[model samples]
Target: MTLLPKNPSRLIREDDRDSAVERLREAYAEGHLTHEELDGRLGRALTARTRRELGAALASLPEERAGTTSTIATAAGRIRRRGAWRVPRSLKVASAFGRVYLDLSRAVIEYPVVDIELRLGTGRAKITVPRDAIVDVEDLRTGWKDTLYKTRRRSRPGGPKIRISGIMGFGRLKIRHARR
Candidate 1:
């Protein structure tokens, strides 16, 4: 029996031309298509200036069956700070105070801050801080690739503070401090 519906839905919509190309590239890189097949399909996709052209190229690709869904749980509270805060996991902290805490054991973080504390656990997490924010990172677990970046010549003395802690497999923490 055919698992997919005889009349399957279109993968790429006419309005999603650019996105279709991007998705095609990702599929090709993931070995979903053979090199020869990818080369021909990629050529067609690149030359597709019109939405219809792009859609046709996308429709020609092989379909991928859906995998198991990923369950993501999250919790957030107020941190007496003036900035955008994002944490991709369940967390509990005194929001009344000017402190941000993240449990990167199962999620990635992307936000604007000056300080950062990273604790990764068996997964990859990425954080983006404001350029003027000072960064302080503490890696508690090893075997996880952790990277920290600072924007040159941008940061105020009293900027936001970031603190992260967890066990990570492959994670990244970035700090973009304010422009000087």
Candidate 2:
């Protein structure tokens, strides 16, 4: 059974192609694919058009395990993460009196689901998730200001799910999904 949908003929997205390339590189580094095979697959990956072609580039490669929880806490400073950083299974962020900016739009989130725990005493916290990500903030408790999340888009069938649970004492917490 293929992982793709029944039609499976849709054009692949740029992010999907990029992810496939990273997986191929990882497989080669792990000695799973030979140099010649890697070169051949890399060409197909870079020029892959449809989902089938993209999937083929990542076929037979073993999956990477999700890492343990990562914690980033600060008393009075800035905490930021962006670029192609690897996302772990769980993330705990605590800020007493500072700004926290977490941009997960370009982050590599391999897991199907992830949990983010936040504890903001007093400061602004901005989080940007992936476009196709599903965010849940049901368990979040806030005071002084309500959490701002204006996205209504649901995650794709195989997209990632982000669950946020935490307590905000006195500040604003804004969560926005990537528009790109």
Best by lDDT: 2
What's the CA error at residue 149 for candidate 2, in Å?
0.7
Best-fitting candidate, scored by TM-score = 2
For residue 71, give model 1's deviation from the true position in Å.
Answer: 7.3
Score candidate 2 by TM-score against the native.
0.67
lDDT of each: 0.44, 0.86
lDDT of 1 at 135: 53
Report the lDDT tens digits of candidate 1 across residue range 2-68: 2633443433444565556556665665567777866777787776655555666777566643432
Tens digits of per-residue lDDT for model 2, 1-180: 747555644878889888889888767766889999999999999998898778888888887666569999999999999876777889999999999999999887878998999999999899999988888999889988999997664556666888999998898889998978
* Candidate 2: segments with Cα more than 4 A from true spot: 1-20, 23-66, 153-155
Clashes of 2: 0
For model 1, what is the error of residue 83's alpha carbon versus the real structure, in angstroms, after optimal superposition? 31
- Clash pairs (backbone) in predicted model 2: none
